[model samples]
Target: MPLYLQLEARLRHMIDSGQLRRGDVIPAERELASMTGVSRVTVRKAMGKLVQDGLVIQKTGAGTFVSGRFSQPLSELSGFSQDMRARGFTPGSHWLDRQHAMAGPDEAMALGVAPGTRITRLKRIRTADDEPMAIETAIVTARDLPDPSMVQDSLYAAFRARGLVAVRALQRLRAGLATQQEAQWLHLKPHAAILRIERRAFLADGRVLDVTYSTYRGDMYDFVVELTASSTTLS
Candidate 1:
């Protein structure tokens, strides 16, 4: 979590615990600066995030007051498509490329296969509401998923519907500069910041089903996570 977010959580915990009761006027900027022992700018940043999350409301003549929350859980993780559907939003996509071919060096190693092995590959530009958001390229061992043409956009749902069990998965995200092709598809300028997501899909019995690399527009979305202190520690 960002330092500003940590400060936000600290204040939010106070609000949730009734330390700062509802309808109670919060401290002023200078007072919060002294109380929280942080710079006034940091306090403002935290308060702004809380307002954006709808946990607080500010009044010009008065002061900040606690607000109602939507009560999101800490244990929810779903794909973008499923998340939008749950919110009653229509989700759709455009097919970019779908083909089957042999795995190269990196794909072969990640899929736990020998070099020059056959692999099924599917590529698509994922979008919602006509705005292209992400470009997904998935690579799977042909021995596991030979029919790459049948994949639409949701590879996880496809795997489950085909009676394949997806036990667990790992995803890595980092900042990336968009390439020419990626920028064109995502409707962003070249070298724009994007979030690169690389995931490895695994079956129940340790069989690697696929490895997917996706680039998401940084501006339109923010990946939210609920993490505990122990999450940063080794098991």
Candidate 2:
């Protein structure tokens, strides 16, 4: 086996065994080379493979650290804050923009409202354990949420407080490259892979409650869906 592959395997084992943990800084290339008696070039190669595999991340001047990747179950209907808390991570948000405005073409269609209908728009950078995870923009009719300021952290929580909780939602996910602005907000390099999710949430009475658009860091987030075999057998 190549020296680089061996080193990569060793690092993977350490991470899997919890000898290394999320946000734990990896040893410098020179130090790793010295410790393993491998060439610095081989150490670099191994580190590069780990980064490509999303097992580690390199901060320009801060060295590489174990990646804090999270998996979200697609079957559950929950807000980011709820999800993060469930995973034992502190969830927070940095508000980018919050205002009341007329619904645009897309937002109007998604919320099943007229284009000129008043709406409250809430945009923020969502974080897990203080690490930027996603950018979210949520829109709702002003009648439901009169003010964006009412939402301090989780939009769903605010909705529930107002007795407007969404009972069901339809979500669509697609792969895309992050825009420069999105990259900056998510602390990722320009053109990095991102997952765009559009969700339309409905109230119990069948009225659309909210239309939310989110861009999640692809390297740090995974969406899991459970599959079940068909009940009927194919002859």
Candidate 3:
């Protein structure tokens, strides 16, 4: 096997086995070359392969580090708090706005509530490990959330405490450039690409629980879906 190929395989193994974890910085190319007894050209080639494969990222003046792109399964109905926690990140929210107001037509339709009905809207900057990850806006019937102040961090957790856990949800995903406001909150340049998600959650009794719109940084998030074929039956 070629020397570069061997180096690539070793790095790949480290990444796959979690030895070189997400956000973990790899050693300098010269150091790797000396340690592995390979030429600097071989190390460079292996690093290039990893970058092309999206397993690592190289930043000028910052060296190379494992990519922090997180893959979220599209099949689950989960909240940002739960998802971030499952990934070993500290989940937090910075409230942008929280208030009660008359439901707009779009919010009413998505939440299955009549227009002009009072509702609670919560706008937050979702953070993981103290870094802003996404911007989210959630709307629920005022009755479901009597006191917006009660929701300290996770709205879903607050709902569960009130016996209103969402049993299912429908979500839509889109790709777009970040708005100026989003870019500011997420610490990205204006017009940077982002993932937009809109979701409607429902309770066991089929009542719409809430509607949420989320914008995630495209560089740090990826959505994955698993599909399977069903058997065909003939009579």
Candidate 4:
């Protein structure tokens, strides 16, 4: 095996075994080279591969550190709170705004409601283990969710309590750069990569339960999709 690949594998093992942890700074290239009796070039190459694989992150002058990236599977329709709990992270939210308001054109269209229809708007910064991860804005018709204040952390939980559970949802994702406000909320530099997600959740009766727009930090979050071989056969 190549020296660099060997080093990379060793580092990966350390991380997996918890010898290295998220936000833990890695040894400098020179120190790693000295400790492993490898060339600095090989150490750098291994670290670079780790960065590309999202196992570590490099700062301009602060050195490299283990990353705390979370991956969510697109095949499962679950809420952020549930996802984080499954990963052993405590999910939290800081309310930015929560009130009843008239649905705008886009919200109305997404919710299949008339423009100016009354709706409950819930805007908050979503957190995992007390670290901000995304900015979420959710809208639901007043007829469905009469009180937005009832939602303390997980909107899905509130909906379930009200017998408005979402059975399925249509979600769309796109890549973008974070705006200044979004960066402030997510504690990232302006223009940092972000993933924008828009989802319309439906009840078992086919009513739109909620329309949620979320912006997640690209560096801290990953969306995975599973694929299988197509059933179609070539002629």
Output the TM-score of candidate 3: 0.79
Give the residue spans of candidate 4 off by over 4 A.
1-21, 24-51, 57-65
lDDT string for model 4 (1-235, tens) is 9999999989976764456767989999999999999999999999999898798999998999999766577888999888777666679999999999998998899999999999999999999779999999999999988988788878888888887788899999999999999999999999999999999899899989999999999987778789876789646
RMSD of each predicted structure: 8.9, 7.0, 5.2, 5.1
> Per-residue lDDT of 114-188 in model 2, one digit per residue for the tens?
899999999999997788999999999999999788998799899888988788999999999999999999999
> Per-residue lDDT of 158-182 in model 3, one digit per residue for the tens?
9989988899999999999998989
Model 1 quality (TM-score): 0.66
Maximum-TM-score candidate? 3
lDDT of each: 0.74, 0.89, 0.88, 0.89
Instruction: Assess candidate 2 and give its TM-score to the true structure.
Output: 0.74
Decide which is better by TM-score, 1 or 2: 2
Error of 3 at 83 (Å): 1.1
Candidate 2 C-alpha RMSD relative to the actual structure: 7.0
- Every model's TM-score: 0.66, 0.74, 0.79, 0.77
Candidate 1 residue lDDT tens string, 21-83: 446677887898898788889889999988887678999988898763322232453455765
Number of clashes found in candidate 1? 0
